[model samples]
Target: MASNWLLLRCRCGQSFGARQGTKPSCSRCGESSQITTTAVFTDPNTLTEAVANANLPSEISQQIENKLNEKKRKKLKSRDIANAGTIQRILKQSTDERGVLTLQSLRVCLDIEGVTEPSAEQIIGMAELQGVVHRAGEDEWKWLA
Candidate 1:
C-alpha cells in the first residue's frame, strides 16, 4: 500500500508534502517545519497506535488539542465578524452628531454578547483591512462609506 503524505506550509510561505512521522525542512529557508495531522485513528491494524505512543506525552497532547481548538474558534469568530453586518451597524451607530467614534465607544456600541475587548479589536482591525473603516486619530475611526 502507498503511504499517505501530509501537506505543510512553512513560515517562509514555502509549501511541501511529507510522509507521516517525518519532520521535513523547508527547501527555501532550510528551517525545520512541524507536521500537522487532521485525523485520529484508534485502529489496531494501523500505525496510529505507534504514532500516538511515540515520545508525545498525554499532557502535551492535551495542550496541543486545546490550542488547536482555540485557534479554530478564533478563526470562526473572525469569519463571522467579517461577513456579518457588524461593520455596517458600527458605522451607523458611530456616525452621529459627534461625527467621531472612539474605540471604546465603538466597542460599547457593538454590544456583541460575551465578546472580549481584544476580540472586538481584532474584528475592528479586520474591518479596517477591508476598507470599511479607517483610523482618524489615535483612538478614533472614521467610516469609509
Candidate 2:
C-alpha cells in the first residue's frame, strides 16, 4: 500500500504499526515510534543564505530566542550533569555481553537508597552522556564498550 507518510524505523529496529494517524508503538514490542523529518543542506553557505533571506515575524523571532536562552540556562544545572556522569560510569563498569542491564542491576549500581524503576528519561540521559548505549534489537541495548 502506498502511504504519503513515510515508514519510520526506531533505533531499536522496530517498525511503526498502522493506525488512523500515527501508531503510538510497535505492535510486537510496544515501543514508541515517533517520527521526525527536517530538510538539511550539506553546504553551510546554502543554509546561511537561506536564513538571511527568510522572512521572520517579530513575535516568532522573539519566541525562538527565548526558547534558545531557556535551553542554555538549563544546561547549567550542576545536579543534572553530575547524575549523568555517575550513571555513565556505572553503566560502563556493570553492563554485560548481552547488553541487557536489568533495572535491578542498574539500581544496585547506582545505589538508589530509595525504591523505584529508574525513570526512562534518566536512563536516556545516562545513555546520552556515555554515547555508547542505544536502543537495540527488540528490548535489548547496543553497547559499544
TM-score of 2: 0.30
Q: Model 2: runs farther than 4 Å from truth?
A: 1-82, 112-121, 125-131
lDDT over C-alpha atoms for residue 16 of model 1:
48
For candidate 1, lDDT tens digit of each residue in 14-96? 44454656677764577784434433333333433344344246448778999998987787675444335655565567565
Q: List per-prediction Cα lDDT, in the order shown.
A: 0.60, 0.51
What TM-score number comes out for model 1?
0.35
Question: TM-score of each candidate?
Answer: 0.35, 0.30
73-107 per-residue lDDT for model 2 (tens digits): 57644433345456566665556666665544565
Off by over 4 Å in 1: 1-83, 112-118
